[model samples]
Target: MKFPVKNELLKRLFAAQGEPVSGQDIADEFGLSRTAIWKYIKELEEEGYEIGSMRKKGYYLIKAPDLVNAANISTYLETERYGRHIHYFSTCPTTQTIAHEEAQGGAADGTLIISEEQTAGKGRLARPWTSNAGRGIWMSLIIRPRLAPQQAPQLTLVAAVAIVRAIEDVAEIQPVIKWPNDILLNGKKVTGILTELQADPDRVKAIILGIGLNANQESEDFPDELQSIATSLKIEKGEHIDRAKLVAKILHYLEHYTALYIEKGFAPIKLLWESYATITGKRITARMVNETVEGTALGISSEGMLELKLDDGTVRGIYSADIEIKN
Candidate 1:
């Protein structure tokens, strides 16, 4: 997503990436006066780019900020394909909803749908996902994997691993994956992954992975019910994070690990998931829609199902459930 600038001057500025572009050069390139070019340079500075303007040597981008808009993200993003096309929204119903529509309309793979806030964000089982304005990462990534529909569930775990790795890379905090979806920090959920697929009975058309990560929220940002159950990277790290950089890192690792998953089987990802597993070898409750079962978690199966050792001296594979780790 390109910014709505009068001209493509911003893209050229970033393309330069520190080498000074003289006002005369910009004026000639954009067919504007030197004064008009200077006005545009000032606008870039006001938009959080620490550009240096000299008397005659013109402007040089000294430092770029970590704003979570399309312009800012494109400035710092280093991924090749994952974030090639980003659709940004200030406020939306949900990135997932729009992503589904886009995917149905034949949007490209690795197209990212991101928003500042989600008014009606959804979680597994129709739970409300809290997404306050400018506080968290409410984004959906579209992927077209050449796999069967059954392999679609593996993408959720793939996203979990990517998110955790990205959090560690950027926030310097190690997050734990709770079974299939939630990424936990200090026993509270800091991120959630919701994977929705557009597929036939045998093949997959596209996978929409909604990643909700709390990057810079304060304790007061969450509702009363979520205050105790949710945490943000800022709250845990005691400093505000660079949301754009974090998102860039996430997209980088996501593209890498997703490609790895497509090539290799789930063996490698399963190993990484176990290293961050908090429920393996613990007592837990699986709250399914029909029945709730209590068991000892014996780790996950080869195919990514939760393996539960029930009290009946039998092991059961859980497909989908709300897991609760009990003492």
Candidate 2:
């Protein structure tokens, strides 16, 4: 259930290598029973972890599954921290919800929660985000940043830049951010981001950054409702994408930009985000929560808000909205 406790067991089992580790050793280390150890090992097997068992040899870890586990992620990450603690699930309602709960319960900054599939995933404005099982990356990052609430919106921009950079590095295709949170490839939606904040009126307590990317899904893999509007990395690149490489790159860039934002300000990240944005200087209609405004999308402000110059000779700042590019 809780991965932290299980992760410790995996670490010990893995350290034993091909040499068998006694059941008593594991029970003593984690205060779990022999039956509990057997249950956890079975659960690992279900997730594709390879374990060997003999009458006298107890249990031996033959191979670690090629999945998004804490050990695998830590090996890929060069940081002393950040993503070192990961909570993985085969299925969940949403990684965002889990991350929120963990953050509230004092989970460390940079804790990551990911799932193979999310049933009730949400996007901006409570939109249902489609996450086909074992098809894409459904993950959320828990961040505890010392920034004002006004500055918190900038994290969305930072995440967008990080994701675009990661896609370029791993997928070898330069995807562009469709201003705000959507990542597009070859004129189709490939990724969506939803940023949630837990804070007071003036300061941020924590921020949960949710990222959903269409990694290895085939065109036919998507539901009928999303077939035309959504596209996956496999569809765009004509091959399956490496989810692990992309995930590592995303975390690297996110850590970099987040540190930059804290040390300097949003100005640098805003400039970089604008450079990778595909929507600026285009005629667009922004569908806000209240109304729609048609204007030339100028650029994002230094504060990471959208700026639109309407036909009525007035400039409007859009805090949050969905944008539709005009032909």
Candidate 3:
């Protein structure tokens, strides 16, 4: 269900900052009847929004529940398009799957498919990704960039830079990117980005970028195997992090960096990505499907491949591989 009218009403109510808004004023602004406005307010109250009304005053937002619904996220969004058309779900198998279908059905650019929980979330190499209920930013975004098919992989690096910038904005922590699509804090995995492409033979169509971020989960929220390797923003920040604000910040940066890549080139994005990379100048081993290569990590290539300097001093550009830091 699309909430164009309710979303605008939410933004207007949030702008009042708990002040009362007259029902007549809202009805006039939206060109809706007073009865229609009352119905919308009732729907919002059913969605966990505690709205109060006065005899003379129209309505006031008393409290908003911490949920990633359309109304809640739209109130904090500052982007022009990235989150404008949101498809929010309470629980889904995966946002990536849904975004792919939406993109195939001609979904608009910057269409976002976000969910509160993912029952069958996937990581790189089809690994099972754990997405705790209401504890992470599990979402996929659909983007249509005018680039060739071969140049699509660089968007993953572009998204990495955006995620790091967003984390920095909300928390006093240093987050680093690990190779193709992992974000780490205190040497533990906190975020993962998976970029999938849909294109023709020559031109490109849409790119579905799946982002899984552990936002407000505690340490004990993970399974035994993941207890040592996984972390969340709440565990690191020592306080509950606001997921809605963080989501908006990520969309804001994602929109900006993607536009920068499309306008200028990968050179600018590569520099920003390297600043937050963890493998530069470190001895690491990259494990691919066919073979493994041990080398000192050079920076990314022009096309966003990991440049690895082997023992014989031969620089190898690894397109896709699992990187292990040796040092």
Candidate 4:
């Protein structure tokens, strides 16, 4: 496979601090010709990077735009396992779709597929998730868990708890999980989790957990339809969020939770998930695929299914549904 010369050159240039780096220096470092280095520099400029060059003063990086390059993410992660294998795209239909394909083709566990913009992103229940270009974190992780197929649903809950914990750690905002799989901030949607599994009746082969978080979008960045219901970290916190730091925190929490779940089971993570969950012990209605069930939300079971105490003095288990907290 050919190396990404532009990415490598950018890395070296950034490492040079404010000093001007000669094209010959970059060429000798990468064992390439000066012409090749110049070509790569032109490509980087075309990608919106402002590189300043003088007749004999060498090249200076004036600005490094926040582009979601795989090498850059790997450099930020600086790890070998999780997020080490990253596939980045400028624009795609959906990161989840690409992740699913990669998982099917035997991608390593903890592989991440991220995109700067997703034109056809989807959320839970096949709802459209709007991700403005370069505005939010549109990514998916592929995990191969050694668990029973029946226990796979718990992964969604695990991801939610991890995300909530990460948000609290970095942004100081206490986000909540709305049942089945949705993260909310101040009663507005901030993050959406979708878990897709390739498994048989007994065991799971691979699981793809897709997460879409509105990070740095301004209020006007969202469409008129979503302004009232959807929110971003910037909108909620009145500041631009560091997407790379958030991604690191999330991956750290996810790695921790996955290890704990495999060792002690979902009981431990379930407790943490319930602790941050805001929907429990409230009057709500669950909109399932077949019908909507009105009930008092009790809590999630050990298997990660929502236990709803319905009317007429009965309780029911909801495997998957959309939950609305009643007034």
Candidates in order, TM-scores: namely 0.89, 0.82, 0.97, 0.84
Q: Could you tell which candidate, 1 or 2, scores higher by TM-score? A: 1
* Candidate with maximal TM-score: 3
Q: Which residue pairs show backbone clashes in model 1?
A: none
Sort order, TM-score high to low? 3, 1, 4, 2
The positional error of residue 145 in candidate 2, measured at the CA in angstroms, is 0.8
Evaluate all candidate structures by whole-model CA lDDT and list the values in order: 0.86, 0.84, 0.92, 0.83
Better of 1 and 3 by TM-score: 3
- Candidate 4 versus truth, CA RMSD in Å, comes to 3.4
Please give, for residues 31-108, the per-residue lDDT of candidate 1 as tens digits.
779888778778777777787876778777788755577776665677777877889888999999999999999898
Q: Which of 3 and 4 is the better model by lDDT? A: 3
Q: Global lDDT for candidate 4? A: 0.83
Q: For residues 198-222, what per-residue lDDT tens digits would candidate 3 score against the true structure? A: 9999988999999999999988899
Off by over 4 Å in 3: none
| Cα distance off (Å), candidate 3, residue 77 | 1.8
Tens digits of per-residue lDDT, candidate 4, 99-199, equal 98998898998898989999999998788999889888999998988999888889999999989998887788878888878888888889999999999
lDDT of 3: 0.92
Flag the better candidate by TM-score, 3 or 4: 3
Show the lowest summed lDDT stretch of 10 residues, model 3. Answer: 1-10
Of 2 and 4, which scores higher on lDDT?
2
